[model samples]
Target: MNSVQKLGFSENAKLLIIHADDAGLSHSENMATIQSLEEGFVNSYSIMVPCPWFYEMAVYAKNNPKFDYGIHLTLTCEWENYKFGPVSPVSEVPSLVDENGYFYKKREQLRKSATPEDVKKELQAQVEKAIKFGLKPTHLDSHMYSVGSDAKFLKVYKEIGEKFDLPVLINKQLMQMVGLDPDINIKEGEFVIDNTYIGEFKYFEDGKLGDFYKGIIENLTSGINLILIHPAFDDSEMKGVTINHPNFGSQWRQIDFDFFTSEINKAKLKENNIELVTWGDLNKIRKGK
Candidate 1:
C-alpha cells in the first residue's frame, strides 16, 4: 500500500510535505523558517544540530510543541567559510572532521574519511543533544544527502531511526543515486515516502520562483511527496554566511521563502487538491497510533 493509504488517507489523495531544511544554520534561516511555519506554506522544518545557531532553534521547538519539526542529521559542513563539527568529542570522532577541526565541506571528503563507527557516534551525539535540549524530533534526514549516499551510512541511519522509533526519510531515487539496490523491500508498517523533491526547479520563465513551484504542485502525484526548501531572508547576515555559494545562497533562499509564503502558491495547493501533511503525522503512523 502507498503512504497515503497507510496514513488513513485515500489512495488517490495527493499528500504533500512542504518541509524547510537547515533551520539552525543561521539567525536568518531560523527566523525565516519560523515565520514560514507560523504564517506561510511551510508546514514542517528540520534543525541542523551541529550548526552554530542550534540552541536558538531548539528553544523555539521547546516552546512551540505544536509545530512539526525533525532533525536534519548533519555530516558535512558545505559552506566555504562557515563550518561546523561533530557533537561527539573531536578526539573520538576524528574521522568526521577535517584538519581545520570543522567537518569536511563536501560529501566526497566525508565519504573518504568517515567510517560507520564515527558516523554512528556523531549521529548519536546529535540526537542526544536534541533530547537534552527538550526538542523531540519527529523524524531523521541527512544533510547534503551524506547519510543516504552510502549503504554503510544508510544502515547506521536506519538503526538510529529504529532505535528512536522515528521515521527516516528514504526513497528510491536516493537509493539508486548512491548505487544501492532500490528494489529492497521496506519493512511492514514502516513509513517510506514515494518521492522527495529538492534543489531548484529548472523551468524558468520571467525568473519567477513561484512559477516553478506552481508547476510542481500541479503535477504532484497521488502519494506522499516531500519538497525540501531552504528558506531565509536576503539580509547581510545571510549573505555573509552564504559567501560565494550562489545556488542555495541568500538570494536563492529568499526566493524560496517568498515563493512558499505567497498567497498564490497557497491557493495553488488547494486548487490542486494537495493534502499537506507533517513529519509528526508520519511519526504517528510509525508508532501505530
Candidate 2:
C-alpha cells in the first residue's frame, strides 16, 4: 500500500497540507503563524530554532500540544540585517557559519563551506533544542530547502528525520528547485509527497498571488500535496527584517497570511474536495498508530 493508503485514505484521495513556513523568525511572524493556525486553513507550521523569537513560539507550542508544528532545519540566514546561527556552539560547527559566526546568506554559500558532519550536527542540535524546550515537533523540514543543495546534506536530512522518527519534506519539485536529481537523491521506500506548490515570483509581482493559490485549490489533484507559505504581518518590523528583498518579503508574507486566513480559501478547499492533512497525521504512519 502507498502512503495515502497507509493513512487510511482512498487511492484517489486528494490530500493537501497548507503549511506555514518560518514560524519563529520574529514576534510578528510567530504571532501571524499562531493566528493562521488557530483561525485559518494553515494546519501546520515549522519553527526556526535559532531565531530570536523561538522562545515565544516554543511556549505556545508546548501549551497547545494539539497543533502540528515541526523543526525547520536552518543553516542559512537569508535576511540583510537579521541573522541567526547554529544551535550547536559556533566553535564546534564553525564550518556552517561565516567569519562573523552567523549562518551564511544563501544555500550555495552553505553548500560550499559546510561539511556533511557539521550540517548533520547542527540540524540534530536544532531538533534536540526544540525537544529540550518542550516542543513536540511533528516533523522536520528545511529553511530555503538548503538540504537539497548538496547530496550529502540530503542524506543527512533523511538520516536525522529517521533518527527522530519524523517525516521530512521530500518531493521531486523541492529537489529539482535546488538542481538535484530527485531520482538519484531519493531512495526506494521513502515518503515523497506527490506535489508541492509555492507562489511564483512573477505571480507575486503581478499581484495575482491570491489567484495562484485559489487556482491550486480549485485544480488540486490526487496524492499527497503541500502548499508552502510564509505568513507574517506586513508591518514596519517585518519590513526591516526583509529589507531589500522583495521576493518573499514582508508584503509577500502579508498576502500569504491574508489569503490563507480568509474564509474564501477555506470554502475553496471544501468546494474542491481537498482533504487537509497535517504533519502530525503523517507522523502516525511511522508509529503504526
Candidate 3:
C-alpha cells in the first residue's frame, strides 16, 4: 500500500512533513528547535550527536518524550570556525576525520578519505550514543545527506537503520543531489520520498524564501512530502559558526525560524487541506512492521 493508505488516509491525501534539521548545532539551534517545535509548524527534527550542543538538546529530548526526533547521522562538519567530529574515538574512525581530528568541511573531502567500514562504524556509533543517553530517537537521517556521497556509504546507511530497527530518510532526489545513481542505489519496493523541498540559495539571496515556501504549500501534491529547514537565531554564536558562509548563514536561518513558526503558515496548510505527519508517527508504523 502507499504511504497515504498506510497512514489511514485516502490515496490522494497530501501528507507533509515539515522537518527542522540541525537541532544540536549550537545553543541558538537548540533554542530555535524547541520554540519551533513547541509553538511552530515544525513537527519533526533530528539531532547532531557529534556537535557540542548535543547534550543540551538531549536533555530536552529526555525530558519531553512526545516530540518527534531522529538522529542526523553526521559525517562532515560544514561550519568555518566551529566544528565537531566523530562520536567514536578518533583513533577508531581515523579515516573519517582530518588531521585536526574533526570531520571534514565538505562531502567531497569526506568521500575521498572515508572508508566504508569507518563510515558504518561512525554512523552506528552515533545511533548507539543517542540511545545510551536515554533519548529514544524515532528515525535516522543524514546530515547534509552525506551518506549518499558514495554507494557503499549509502548501503551502510540502510544497514545501520536495519540494525537499529528504525526507519531512515531515504529518497532518490537526495541521493541524486549527492551524485549517487538512484535507480541503481535504491532497490525496488523501497520507501522513498521523491518530493522533498528545501530553501534554495537563490531564495535566500532574493529575500523571497517565505514566498518560496508559501508556493510549496499552495502546490503540494499527493503522497508524502518533506520540507527540510534549519531554525536558528541570527546571533553571535550562529554568526561565529557560519562565518563567511552566507548561503545557509545566520540571517538565512533566522528567516527559516520566523517563517515556519508563523500562524499564517499553519493556517495555509489547513486551508489547503494538507495533512502534517511526523517521524515519530512513521516510527510507530516501522515498529508495527
Clashes of each: 0, 0, 0
After TM-score superposition, the amount by which residue 281's alpha carbon in candidate 2 deviates from its true location, in angstroms, is 1.3
Top lDDT model = 2
lDDT of 3: 0.91
Q: Regarding TM-score, does 1 or 2 come out ahead?
A: 2
Supply candidate 3's per-residue lDDT for 199: 84
Error of 2 at 43 (Å): 0.2
For candidate 1, lDDT tens digit of each residue in 83-186?
78988889999998988789888777888889999999999899989988888888998887788656788889989988888888887776665566766634
Worst 10 residues of 3 by lDDT: 280-289
TM-score of each: 0.94, 0.98, 0.98
Error of 2 at 146 (Å): 0.4
Show where candidate 1 strays beyond 4 Å.
177-181, 184-190, 201-208
Model 3 TM-score?
Answer: 0.98
* Weakest 10 consecutive residues of candidate 1 by summed lDDT: 199-208
Question: What is the Cα-based lDDT of residue 134 in candidate 3?
Answer: 93
Q: Is candidate 1 or candidate 3 better by lDDT?
A: 3
> Which pairs clash (backbone N, Cα, C closer than 3 Å) in model 3?
none
Pull out the clashing pairs in model 2: none
